[model samples]
Structure formats: C-alpha cells, structure tokens
Target chain A: MTREHLLPENDATGKQSVLDRYDLWGQYVYGFLLRALSSPSLAAELTVSVFDAFREAKETGLTDLLARARETAVAALQTANELRLQEATNFDFRMAQRQSSDDGLLLNEKLGKAQSALEPKCKTILEMAYFNGLSQKEIEGALNLPDGSTGTRLRRAVNDLRRVFALN
Target chain B: MDLKAYMTSGMLELYVLGLASEKETREVERLAEEHPELKKEISTIRKALDEYAKLHGVQPPEELREKLEKSLDGPPTQAAVSSRPMVKPAHRPRNKKFQLGWKHLFALAAVLMTIVAIGMAVLAFDYSDRLAVATSTNVELKEDLSKVSAELVEVKKANTNLQEKLGFLASINTRQVRLNATRRAKGATVLIYWNTDQERAFAQWDQLPELPEGMQYRLWAIARRNFEPLSDMQSVSSPAGDIHQIAFVPGASSFVITMEKADGPDYPNLSRMYLQGSLN
Candidate 1:
C-alpha cells in the first residue's frame, strides 16, 4: 500500500490562511517563478519581487497583507511545510496534463488561455485572491467600497471569470 | 440552518468559486461563522476547484520567465501585450473526467490487507508441512535403528560359535560324532557336540519332525545309577539351534530326548522317550 503521511495544517496563526507562514510563501513564490521562468536567476529575482510587494504593502498599511491573509481560499491551500506544498503544486501541475483533443478533458484549454488573456485588473484580482493571498475584505477596503459592496463585486467578478474560463 | 435560502441565493457556489464581491464575501464569511455546514460546503467546493486549477496550472516559457524576471529585477521589458496567454498549452480540452473517491481508497486498502493475510497463511502452511514430513522420517529412521540392533545381537552369538570351533582345530585330538533321532528313522539327525578340555557336552540337532500337538522333545543324561536330565530341549524348529555348552551343575553329565507334554519333565519321562544319547 502507498503509505502517504498527511501532515497537519501549517497556519501558524491557526486561522483560515493560505501560506500564512512566511517560509511557505517564499517557497511557493520562488517555485512559481522558477517553473514559470525555469531559470534560477529569474526565480531569485521574482522571489525578491513577491517579498518586496509584501513588504511595501505592509509598510504603507495598504490593506494588501490583510487581503492576502483573509483571502477566500486560505483554508483549502494551507499545508504543513513549505517544501511539501511547493512539491505537490509543482509535481501535480508540471507532470499531469492531457495533450490530445479527444482525451475527454474537463477544463477548457481555450477558455483557460482566454482567462489568462483577460485585462490586467481582472488578472490581478483573481491571482491575488487565488495565489497572492489577498482577501475580499481587504480588497473591499483597498477599493474603498461601501461597507457591504465588496463581497458582491468579488462574487460577480469571479462568476464572470468562471464563465469566461468555462467557455469553449 | 438557512441552507435553502443560501442555495437559492447562489451565494455558496459563488463564494466557493471565489466569485463573491467584497461585501458578499463578508456576508458569506459571517454565514460560515454561524453555520458549520455552510463552512463545510465552502471547503468542499474550494477543494474541488483548487484541485482543478492545480491540474491546469500555467507553465510560462523560459523566455517569458526570463523577460518577467528581468522586468521584476530592474525595468519592464517591453513587449506587445498580446490577447493570447503565452503559457496556454497547445492542445484541445477534454471533459467529464471522474474523480478518485473514498470507496476506491477503502477498496484498495482491503485488497492490500487480504494479500498480506494470504501470504501469512501460505507461509504457515509450508512450515506445518515440513514438520509433518520430518516427524514421519524420524520415526522411520528409529525403526531402522532398532532392526539393526537386533541383527547385531545375532551376529555376536554367531561370532562366539566360530571362535569355539576354531579352538577345536588347534587341539591335538579332534573328535566328532554323528547321531540320529531313534524313532525318526530317516527324518531327524543330530551331531554330538565338541569342546576343548572337556569343557561341557554340546550338540547340534539337524532335522527333527514337526511334533504333534500336546507333545515336545526333551533331553536326558543316562547314568548307571540315575537317568538324569542333562540339557533343556523342546520340539526343534531351526536347522541350526545353538549347542553352546556353557557350564552346567557338577552332578549332570548325560543327555537324551523324549516325547512329553509341551514342557519336558525335569526327571526323564522315559515312557515317552523319543531320542537318546549318552556321553562316556
């Protein structure tokens, strides 16, 4: 049998969090940059960028850190160690994609391509919400939305994005 | 608690897909805070969608990565912002893929456990089989050893007889006599025994008739004054019965045979005499 050891959640704060630990954040950002760039030099550079962004937001009290901390997917993506999370993400994404047209795939490659082609604003919001660890509440505060409008806008934006991604 | 309303509101699925606006996100978060099932549904949807995204994550080219890296390092590298995603895989999409489920996981575990159990059973069976074979072989070996021991005893008896005969060959006077069963006519014969220095009387009865039931042959020693028993004898079976004349009491010197009860009498049953011999 495959003896897989499931690890405990790594949220140091013990709250709903995605990469709440800095070590994991560094690993994931570095991994993303490495896979996307496939060069150590570029990965190192992007590592600086992600942390730099984090620091800049923190210094200014720009609500971005809270945005990330309270991000909608914090709970699902949390892991016990930076290395395992990075490895799992890298292994699953890098190795296991279908290539043929008639393999009966679930995700729409065309729509995926289109979603990635979206306006920089939409891309930023979704990626920050998904990968950059920004929360809708923080986004609402950042955008200066009325007290109750942030969740509605986020939901509407996401549904639109999903439809775009779903379209063949 | 308000699952029905929550469902019709389409808040749960949208929140799960990360579709809710900032304020809507707060609302859903608040509902999740109050109701565990809502949180549960949220977690499940997020997990499924997250897995889906992970399966289809973008792999930007090394060149694009380099450009992005360079831009992040210093200045933005200028390229036309194309509408197409550079990282999009060059392939068509597929659909209706089934997910791996808990039942499959449990089934796999059960099969693995069964395989282990069967392996143990086979090993135990082999061990028992070996034990049975060894025990039977051990018993047969013991039987063979006992038979060999009995044969060794007989060999010792024969060896002593040969040694006595060899002594006769060394003596200055060597005498041998032939005798017969008186009533047998032609069926029974015997040999007068020999020993060095008059050690003792000895004989070998050769051929004797199969006796009728209720009768046996005996030996007697005849003297001028007394008909005394010399040796113990009975209906003979083997052609070569040992006549090793080991020391007898000083008083008895003659030998004879008679028909008596199965057990011969201590005194000569002269009335039932079948064979007679006397020593000078």
Candidate 2:
C-alpha cells in the first residue's frame, strides 16, 4: 500500500495515523525474525517488540524505520537463539558447543525442499512442528487432531521428508 | 536398550522439531548421552529442520503486522518507550539503605538544571519560529489590504463620475422627450434627455427591437426649418437607467432613429425609421 493508505484519509500528520502506518512494517520485521528464529509465532511476537522500539525511538519515515526495524529484529532473534541454546544445554542434550554452522544451513535447505514436496497433511504437521516450533500437544490442538494422532502424523511427515531426500 | 530401534523410532525428529515435552526431551537426552551415535542423529534432525525453516519461512499475516505495530507504538507502550531515551535507575531493593551526600545532591541539582535549561531553549526556539511565521502572515495581510484600498479608491472615483451624470440629468435645463416606436418596432418606445444649456443629449429605453447582426440604431436630429439630418447619436441604444449620448444638434425640433450598419451612417434611412419624436 502507498503511504497515503497507511495514513488516515483526513489527517496524515496525526501521531496516531503515523503510528498506524508504522504498523504495516510488522510483516517485514516478522519475516526477518522468522528466518533467524525459525518460528512464525515467536517472530510475530518479537516483531511487536521491534515496533515498540521504533515507537519508543519516535522515529519517522518508512525507509529509515524499516532499516532500524530489521536491526531490532536481528538483535531480538539473537537473544532468542541464545535462549534456545541454553534450553538445549539445560536438557543435558550434550550438543556441540556451536550450532550456527554452514553444514546445518545446507541440511535445512535440503529438508525444506523435501518438506515442500510432501502431501498437505504431512506438510501442515511438519510446518507446525518445525517452523512454528509447536509441541506435539499444541500442534494437535491447533490442527484439531484426534487424541494420540499428532505423533503418528509427525512421524509420517518426517518419514516422507526422509524418503524425498533418500535419507532412509 | 535396542539402540538401532530407538534411532529409527522417529523420536529424534520430535525432539529436533521441539514437539517433545520436557519429559520426552529429558528421555531423549538421557538415551543420546548413553549412545554417542544417537546424539549425532538428534543433531542431524535438528539441523535438517533448521535448514527447512531457512528455505521455507512464511511471513506473518500482513494484518497481524499492523496490529503488532499499533500495540508497539500505541498507548500501551508509549509510557515505557517514549521518544527520548529514559535513563533507567539501577534496580535496588526498597529495604536497601540509602544515604545522600553533598556530592550526590550537587549531581542531582546539576542534572535538574540541565534539563530545565534544555526545556527553556526548546520553548524559546518554538516561540521564535512561531513569531517568524506570524510576522510573515502579517506582512502578507498588509499587502492584501493595500491592494484592496487601491481598488476601493478606483471604485470611489467611478461613483463620483456616475453621480455627476445623475446631477446633470436632474438639472432644470434638462428636457425629456418620449420617442414613439414605428410600425416596424412596436412596443420599443425610447426617452431622450437633452440639456439645452449644456448642448448635450442622451437616450434611455426599456426594450428595443432585436437588431440584426452587423446592424444598429442611428439617431438623427431633424432641424425644425427643413427637417434636414443633423447628427447621429454617439452610442447604440442604451438599457434603462443607462444613458447613451447623442450628438448635440442646436435648434433641432425633432429626432428620428433608423436601422443602419453597425458602424452607423451619415444620413438617416428614412424608410427604416424605427423611432421618431419632437421636442416641446
């Protein structure tokens, strides 16, 4: 949408209208955060924080605001990534000390293509579990799956991806 | 434990996707710890999911972005996130002992003074800008007023000219003559004003018959002795209240108006005579 649409019809100078226009930047911020966080809900939530920072800064202009917004999203994503790493260690998973690896990026790309090739049900389940970072129980609730079906659906999705990638 | 069976059970995928609960996660960790190969498999699954996400990340709803931005910049966040960076005081317990020293008092006073100075400067700058704008507006208004005053003077001069004409029309020496419309121009009677003393004349009328394009009415003064053509009117037939001057003709006993070329004719077109009158 143009800046005119972002602003109220009558008053473009009003602070509230300016803020309303700023709200449209959330999608961009969310997308940036999602790439780093790998979860839509978390990215969306942090997108709010990024905008809050912008408002707090009392910044103006979409170009400048979006530039600042991307930086804010990156910072929040880094914090979230640290927390996720801490969680993995807290579970005593004994994972390698470092995770932000190039090999992992390659694997994610291959796995993503395989997931996209899966059937609708498998894709939906896998997306909720992997991209949305939802627990099986939460996925079941979100998808309205029958009791105990979430795990079966998740395994089927993973197996489908494995087949596509010729991993099994 | 059947380590090979556990590796193929898809539990690693659940753990990698974060779909495993705290208890399930703990179990997975415990088994992966006992078997290094199991840990490697869990790591591989997690890496795969991360790659998938990087390749196929979905953007949040466009509407949701707006909502989030609103909530961020709106009333809920304004106080906490004002434009100015607020210096947050270090967190301290209410029970912590606090002592104020002279140095502390001086520092606090200095900060307050600085804030006050900044506020006054801002106010002064704002006032200066507003004053400049007001001054410019006043200058524009003055220019407009000057233009309006000049126009008013022109209108007054015009009014005086009209008043002089009216006064002349009301003079004792002015004579009025009613001109009768001819058969061709029925209902087109006209009145003529003649000031004998000033030797000037004008004509007034309510309605005149429509003239053909490039044609006009010409008034002729007919001398009493010979009824010879004297002089034609200077202007075309004028509307009521507006006077059209006719050329002065001394000793003229009558007047006759005829239709002629718009530029007018030196002699009257007797056959096309539209109006005729005799003076008292």
Candidate 3:
C-alpha cells in the first residue's frame, strides 16, 4: 500500500468507518484470540478463524458471540480501576525480587481479593483485556500507546504479580 | 535441550493469559508447534490454569460461551463435542479393497490433480473477492477526497467574489449634498451609491431627527429640464441598517430633496425643497 493510503482519511460521518467496520460483529475476535492464544502468531491465525467462524456464524453462531460479549461487558464493571492499578505495582516488585520460580502458582493464590500482593499492572492488563472488551486496535485507538507496550506491560505485570505471591 | 529451564521460564503462563505481543505470540506459537515437548509443556501449564479458573467458576454468567460461539460462527466447543454423534468406524462392515497397481496409481494422480485444481480455484475466487472489496472501498474514499479537494476551489471562488466587490466599491469617488435645518427637519446624512461604469445612482438616508407626526423626506433626481422624485421616506424604525436604498436613477443633471408629510405628494412642494445640488 502507498504511504498516502495508510494516512488517516475521514469518512463523511467524521469517523474512521473502516476500522470501526471490523467491529461489525464486535466479537473483537482478534483481541479474544490474542488473549486466548497468548502467542501473537497463533492469535493472528486464529484471528482469521474467529472471523471465519464469525462469517459462518453469521448464519448460525453469531448470536452466541454477541450474547457472550454483552454478558461479559456487564460483568466487567465489577473490576475497578483502583484494583487494576494496585495489581500492576504489586506484580512488579515481586518480579524484581529475583525470587523463587514458583511465582505463577503463588500468584494464583494471591489473585483472590484476600491477598494484597496483586500487582496493579497485572490487574490492569487483565481488566483491559477482559472487562473493557478493548481490541488491541481499540486500546491503541483510545490510549495512543504502542501495541507492544501493552504486551510488555502485561508480561511484566504478570511476573510481578507472581513474585508478590513469591511462587518460587 | 534445557527443557526444564524453558518450561520453568513462566512465559507459558502469560501465553495462556493472552498477554504476549504479536511478535512474542508469534514466536511462542512457532516454538510450541515446532517442538512437541514445548507444546506439551505449554498445554500442561494451560490445563492447570484452566482447571484452576474453572474451580473458581466464573461461569461468566449465563449465555457467555453461547455469545462467544455465535460471534465465532463456531459452537461452544464442549457442546460441539458432546452433542456430536459418536463415530462407529470400527463397527462398519469391512469394505472390499482393490489391490494396488496401475489403476490405483492413475486414480491417485487424478485425485491429487483435482485437489490442486480445487485449491487454485479457491485462491482465484478469494483474490477476486478481495479485489472487488478493495475497488469499492477505494471508490468510496476517492469520492470523499474529491469533495475535500473541491472545498478549496469553492472557498477561492467566494474569496474572489468578495475581493472584486470590495474593489468595485473602492473605485467610486462620491460627494453628498446636505440641506440646512428648516422649519420641520434637522441634521441628516444620505449614502449615495454610484456605479461609474454604468452611470447609475442608488440612495439611502440616516440619522435625521425623527420626522413630525405625519411628515417624511422626499427625494428628486433632477435633470436640466425635468424632475422626478426617487424615493419617498417613511419614519425610521431601527437606529441603523434600516435605511432603504432607492432604485434606478435615470440619467441625472442634479438632485432636489424635500420634506413633506408622511404621505408624500406626487410632486414636490417647491418650498419644501430643503436641499438642491446641480449637475455642474
């Protein structure tokens, strides 16, 4: 594609209708697959399947995805921004400790509300992915942050969260 | 290989968490698919986590998976598996088998050829669809772009019209005639618009103290031999911008303006000719 084509163009309604067009089903299958697979390449390939499933689902399965999204979106409100912030910071300090390798299992235990060991970033990443129903595109659109920043932050957040529980 | 260290890295957990970057995700996927042991390790970790989350039972509310499945055009996989009829391949009759020879080889070749042909056809069809979509998208965008381009030209045309009118107004040199205060009237100003090129006149009046209960101003454009009243005045309404422009001044010698009652007469009262100016 030419550079000019990549440059932003406005749709008559004063919006980028093209990118928004992908959200037609708003399954945000791309984001779902990204979170589900955790492997970007796998996620992308599955992205096609999600759409393919979506395309085929148009006749049959689509109602389910939409219903699921709605259900999840409503339940999403329970997770707060304050919780998300705390989860990220707690996760990081643990990772920095160079602690034992059992952090993953330990992190799991701490994930319950009873444990204050949760890192703010980990909570943010989870909340961002699950509750907000934001696609990477939406996150990029809303935050103007690089796509990689989210992944990096997520990984770092997870590591820190694990460390707080001190799994290793 | 250090499989233990690799598995211990804890990256697989994030992989399950779906937190990896595209590049990182791609690398993890490539590594998992390429290495069976790594794939097994990752799946093991995921299984453990999935089971764990399941115990907590987000249940994610009723209709969550159903909603997800609907969007995917796929089923709740668990439902798909459980709902499907079990395969009974073992119970099927032992079908007759042809001994492998020239016939089987030809059949194999034809099957391979057919598959290749079908794949090519699918690729061609997909490409055609992509092209059609891209072309339509381009056409839609181009129409909008052209509209944006047209705005600049429209603005330029409007600007030129305004500039030309301003220049036209600036070119004319004009003088106004004033009459001294008389029995009924005081100070007044009239703006006369003259088109030098067309040799025409337009006139309006302002800021004379309000007229008496039934009086008005009458205008006459006078030539050397004859006189014609142009605009007869009504009482002023608003303080400004309410002045009325009188249309069409026939070829003029000079002008005679007078004061009269609000209802003006066909001919000026010569005595009421408050002001007069000549062609010379």
Best by DockQ: 2
Q: State the fraction of real interface contacts model 1 keeps.
A: 0.01
Candidate 2 docking DockQ: 0.08
**What TM-score would chain B receive for each of the candidates shown?**
0.40, 0.44, 0.34
Q: What is the lDDT of residue B220 in candidate 1?
A: 53
For model 1, the stretches where C-alpha displacement exceeds 4 angstroms are A1-168, B1-135, B142-158, B165-175, B194-196, B238-241, B246-255, B262-266, B278-280
lDDT (Cα, tens digit) per residue for candidate 3, span B124-174: 899879978988998999899999899989999978866754554566444
lDDT of model 1 at position B4 = 57
| Candidate 3: tens digits of C-alpha lDDT, residues A99-132 | 3224333533444542244456345544454433
| Tens digits of per-residue lDDT for model 2, A6-113 | 454544245465457544443334544554454445556766665555544544545444445445544443234433322222221011101324533444555446
Question: For each candidate, what TM-score against the reference?
Answer: 0.28, 0.29, 0.24
Which of candidates 1 and 2 is the stronger one according to TM-score?
A: 2
Error of 1 at A126 (Å): 99
- Give the range where candidate 2 chain B is weakest over 10 consecutive residues by summed lDDT: B50-59
lDDT minimum window of 10 residues, candidate 1 chain B: B52-61
User: Evaluated on chain B only, what is the TM-score of candidate 1?
Assistant: 0.40
Docking class of 1: incorrect
- DockQ scores of all models, one per candidate: 0.01, 0.08, 0.02
Q: For candidate 2, write residues B1-280 as lDDT tens digits.
A: 8887766666777776555779989999998888899887765554444334334323355566566545644564355546778788898788989899999999999999999999999998998799789889989999999999999999999799889789879999999998766544567768888888999877776555665455566776766443444334333446445776767878877777765665644655343456677774
